[model samples]
Target: MDDIRNIYCVGRNYRLHAQELGNEVPKSPMIFSKPTHALVETTGQEIVLPGNRGEVHYEAEFVIHISKPYKPGMKVEDVVDQFALGIDFTLRDVQSELKKKGHPWLLAKGFPNSAIITKFRAFPGVEACKEVDFSLIRNGQEVQRGNIQDMLFDLETIILFCSQHFGIGAGDIIYTGTPAGVGPVTDGDRLQLKWGEEILGECFIRLG
Candidate 1:
């Protein structure tokens, strides 16, 4: 986690997630970012978040790590070296207000500890990735499940967009976006991120 540089994220990349939030499907990849300081690794520790701000929502996503400098027309396998499950925690109320006012989501999305990631593992090429499911389990029940095949904007497209616009390179990570079933998480909640049958990470939440 210490080696991580830029944190890029995709918004509304899942069609169902867009409709669930009453948002239109984007014509292109909707990109946003968080400062590196926003990152927190999930290692069975207590993850604290703002409690007075409003509802905090959990968005489970497939996180990709870039291992080499991106070049135009490079395949996803060429640039990406690892993958992991992550949570794009959001201050829902703050985000809603920001949306209504047509403002940036920095306040709601870029807070410290808002970006939660698990340990990274070797990237098994794109084909093998599409066959598995990644999910979030809160307490004991599954809340969100997604696969790379379901993304409205696939990895290749997302990588291209980010590279062209944000200058993606080694050390940058992309939170590929969440699926439907997003909801608030309260203090004392136990969150688990999984890829297939393997538990990538787990942590308890503490609102402060």
Candidate 2:
């Protein structure tokens, strides 16, 4: 995980997720970013966050790892080397305020441990990915599940957009967006991330 460079994220890439958050569905990819220091691996250990924040919501996503420098015409399968399930932990209240003020989301999205990911596995190609379902399990109950086929902006579109506008390259990872069931996570919550039926990673939450 330490080798990761840029952390790019797409917001409201799922139509239902936009509606659930009272946000309009974007016509194009909604790009955002978190600093690299926000990353923490899901090693079944306790990860801590600010307890005083109003609410910390978990947005589970499909994380894509770029293997080589991106080129405009390259396919996702050609550039991507691995994939994993990850959580984009948000300070929801802070984000709401930022949105209202028309400000950047850095304060809400870039806190320590805000970006959590499971171990990466070899990329299985785009079609193979669309056939699998990834999910977030909280306290042993599934809270969010998603498949790549449902994304408003698919992998190719996202990669191209990021590469064209922001410049993607090796060591950058994209958090491809989450599904509709996002909600607040409290301290002591055990969160598990799964790809298909295999549990990729799990961790306990601790608020300080």
Candidate 3:
């Protein structure tokens, strides 16, 4: 996690997710952020959840690992090709209240241990990322499944849009958003993120 400089997240970037959450599809991308310190080092450790933050939801996302320094004027094709699988944990109830008050989701979104990711790998190509199947399973049950075909904005578009707004730099990561079927995670739940038959990452939930 220390390798990442900034964490940029795109909210409701899947049509089904936006509809299920009753959020209107944005004309452009809806972006938010989490602090790099919020990243939990899970190399060989189980994830310990922050207590008393309301119901925390598990959102599986395709994480893009930037290979080079990026600025606003950069083109999408200039981005490096590394990627990974990860979970963007959200305090759903907290986010709801913040949304109602028309407030930014800093606390609700950027709390400690919110960003969990697997090791990065070279992205095969656009056709591969676009067609690859990914899913999130909790306690041995598949909960969220998505493919790049369903993304409202493809990978290049997401990176380009985010760079324009956030001034992405080297080692920055962009979470391209989650699919539908996101729900609360409880204590003792074992979570696994998979791409096809291969398990990309796993995190054990230990809530106090």
Candidate 2 residue runs with Cα over 4 Å from true position: none
Q: What is the TM-score of each candidate against the true structure?
A: 0.99, 0.99, 0.93
**For candidate 3, which ten residues in a row score worst on lDDT?**
69-78
Off by over 4 Å in 3: 41-44, 70-77
For model 2, how does the per-residue alpha-carbon lDDT over 36-74 read when each residue is reduced to its tens digit?
999999999999988897899999999999998887678
> What is the full ranking by lDDT, best candidate first?
2, 1, 3
Q: Cα deviation in Å at residue 25, candidate 3?
A: 1.2
Candidate 1 stretches greater than 4 Å from native? none
lDDT of the candidates, in the order given: 0.95, 0.96, 0.84
User: lDDT tens digits, residues 1-208, model 3?
Assistant: 5678888999999999999989999888888999987776446358887668789989999888787866656555577668888889988999999999999999888887888888788878767677678999899999999997799987778887776777767788888999999999999889988899888888799876
Q: After best superposition, candidate 2 residue 83: deviation in angstroms?
A: 0.4
- Model 2 per-residue lDDT at 128: 96
TM-score of 1: 0.99
- Ten residues in a row with the worst lDDT in model 1? 66-75
